[model samples]
Target chain A: MDIRTLCLGILALGDATGYEIKKMVAEGSFSFFSEASYGSIYPALTKLTTEGLIECRQESQSNRPDKKIYSLTEAGRAALEDSLAKDPRPDKNRSEFLASLLFAEAVAPERINSLVQDRITSHKRQIDALKLMRAEEDSPVGQFVLDYGIQVQQAAYDFLIANKGRIVTKL
Target chain B: MDIRTLCLGILALGDATGYEIKKMVAEGSFSFFSEASYGSIYPALTKLTTEGLIECRQESQSNRPDKKIYSLTEAGRAALEDSLAKDPRPDKNRSEFLASLLFAEAVAPERINSLVQDRITSHKRQIDALKLMRAEEDSPVGQFVLDYGIQVQQAAYDFLIANKGRIVTKL
Candidate 1:
């Protein structure tokens, strides 16, 4: 999703600063499905505010810049619902590591072996995060989503482990 | 992968017109892993030619605009290999549907159900495409890549099918 729509949806749940929105995406259940950098998030918030879909309150903080807390307006809630009703773009799993593996013959045997191990390790980490998030959530949908991520990541790790020998030998 | 590097890689494989390059990406094994639009391709080709990384020749057609057939130079091959040697960026999957699903309670019942069905159908189609691609190739690496796509996509489809009813009822 575009950062603008994502910010609006997050605000619909509760008010948050721009930093909080980025933090939520990076560390929350949303991390696997969606992500936005500060560069994208800050600009999206400014545009959403100008469009009047969200309202912001500047709160002073000790030893820090004033935090801009943004909340969804009624229009923002409506917008979020409307966007949800539309057909979403297909999910992308654009793994550079997987793509690089296609050219494994070009790399050294040791390099390819290390790359395969790294991918399996990373998948394991994501699976662990998904489990933790699933534990913390009550929403049936959230649980369902986490379950999907866990299964897919685990499947990938298994495939890597099972096939690593041939791939390494060929490399 | 960025469009510029993708274009470079395709040229490294063989000389091809811009239209041919687009067709390759649309229907080739690369479809599963990367994509680029004409908006990015044409400009990239123009820049590459100016930088001496590629050479383009205009071939006039019967009724269409002249086609530019681009070929990679020695410099281009070196550039591509250099890019391959660098640590590639991590893969990123951006899904609007999953993000919206996290807020299923906000959307209409019919919309949620239809969206789930649509997403499931899309992933199934991708899995089918990957299967067809697998049958056309005999290399172990190609087979592995295609199977990887299938494993991940099927997992996604199963998750949606299993959870459809819960999302529909809550919507």
Candidate 2:
């Protein structure tokens, strides 16, 4: 998704500093489905403010840079709703582990097993995190997103566990 | 993974035109996990050739643009192996559908169902494609990747079919 739309959505939740916006975009509830670096987030926020979809004010802070707080305008809320109503853009998922495994024959057999093992360990952590998040989410939308993450990750972990033997020993 | 390493891996498969390389990268094995656009691929190929990792030979076609076929050199093979042996980068996956669904309350009740139904139908097509691909893949690495795609898509399809109504009705 465009960082502009995402910034509007975040500000709609509540007022936030640019730092908070970047943090939430990277690691919050919607992190799995959306992402933006500070480079992108600051520019997006600036543009949204210029377009009047959002408004920001400055706050003085001790021993730190001044915080710029942002909130969604009424127009921003409508824009977000309109965006959600439209057809979503196609997904673009990146998995370097899968890419490496595709070239498994070139590596030592143990390394293939190692990679799969590492994936399972990391993925399990994600599934557990999602499970906890799902438990706390009362909104159907939040639940739906959490369930999606859980299902996909669980499937990956299951596949690796069930099939690793077949591939690992053969190489 | 970086496009340069990915181009090396694609060339390791066999000699392929830049057009063919992009197709395979976007649609072939590991596609769901790794991606590169023609914008990145051409540069990657050029740089690989310059670095002595890949060699390209021009093929004159009768009525089409002259094709450049890329092949992996011994150094390229070693580089790919070395890459595989290293820890894979963390995955960054985007699901625009899931992102849209996260705002289900903001959208009309019926549109939520519509979005989910579209997602389920499209996801099933991917599951079917992966199944067909898996059946033909004899290599262990190829089979692993296909199975990964199938398992995840299948899990998603199942979840949507079973739980979508509960979420849809409440929205």
- Highest DockQ against the true fold, candidate: 2
What TM-score, over all chains together, does every model reach? 0.87, 0.92
Model 2 per-residue lDDT tens digits across residues B1-171:
888887777676668888887888677766677777899888878888999998888989999989888888988888888888789977887877876766545534556878988998889888877888788888878887888888988998998998887767663
Per-candidate iRMS values, in order, are 2.4, 1.9
Docking class of 2: medium
Scored on chain A only, each candidate's TM-score is: 0.88, 0.86
The residue-level lDDT of candidate 1 at A160 comes to 81
**For model 2 chain B, the run of ten residues with the poorest summed lDDT:** B101-110
Model 1: per-residue Cα lDDT over A1-171, one tens digit each:
778889987887679999999998998988887888899999999999999999999999999999999998988888888788777877666666765665433323345666777888888888898899899988777777788778888888887888777667553
- lDDT for each candidate structure: 0.78, 0.80
Off by over 4 Å in 1: A103-111, B56-68, B107-110
Q: Worst lDDT window (10 residues) for model 1 chain A?
A: A102-111
lDDT of 2 by residue, A8-117 (tens): 76666568988998887677777777778889888888888898888988989999988899988888888898887789876887888887776666534567778888
True contacts kept of 2: 0.76
